[model samples]
Target: MSTDNSEHMRTIDRWLAGEVVNNTIGIKVVGGPFDGRTKIVLLGEDGRPPAVIRASGGPAGPSRHAYEAVRSTDVRAGWIYTYTGPEPATES
Candidate 1:
C-alpha cells in the first residue's frame, strides 16, 4: 500500500490554523493490524498525549481499530502505542 501521510499532515495544518500551537507529536503503532504505522496527534493542554487513538482502514462505518499509548521516552518521536483491538460496539 502507499505510505502517504498527507491526511496526517492536513490534520496538523488544521490545528495550526486554529492556533493550537506546538502540541503536535508523533505516535508509533506497535502490534496489531496497523503495526509499524505512524500518526500525528495533538497533545493536551497539560502537555500529555492522548490515552487512546482511533483509526479506520477505509471509509467504512466505525473505526476499525484503537491504539492505547503504552509509554513515551520522547514526546516528539518516541511515543509508543499498542493496538487495543477493534472498536467497541455502540448503541444504535
Candidate 2:
C-alpha cells in the first residue's frame, strides 16, 4: 500500500512540477473498478506528467469546465481535467 501511495505521490509531484503536458497523458484506474468514485484521472502529453483536478463543490457534468475556465485565463497554470472521484487517500 505504501508503494502505491509512493508511486501516486511521485506521479503527482511530477505533474505539479510542470513536467507533464495535456492531451498526451492517459489515466487508468489501477486499484479498483471504475466505480465513478475512484476512477477520475488526468491525462498529459506524452513523456510528460499528468495531474488530477478537482472542484470545491462536487462532481458535475462538462468535465472540461474547470479546465477551460482556468485555461482561458492563464493557459498553463493547472491540470486540464476536473476530478469526480473519491478524494485521494494520501497527498504529498
- Tens-place lDDT digits, model 2, residues 1-92: 79999988776655444344333322322221231222224443443234343333333432221222112122233333333444544544
Error of 1 at 13 (Å): 14
**TM-score against native, each model:** 0.60, 0.28
lDDT at residue 53 of model 1 (Cα atoms): 82
Clashing pairs in 2: 20-49, 21-45, 24-44, 24-45, 25-44, 37-86
- Name the top lDDT candidate: 1
In order, the Cα lDDT scores of the candidates are 0.68, 0.36
Candidate 1 residue-wise lDDT, 1-92, digit = tens: 23468765766665433323467766677777777666667888876668898887743444578889876664335467787888877777
lDDT of 1: 0.68
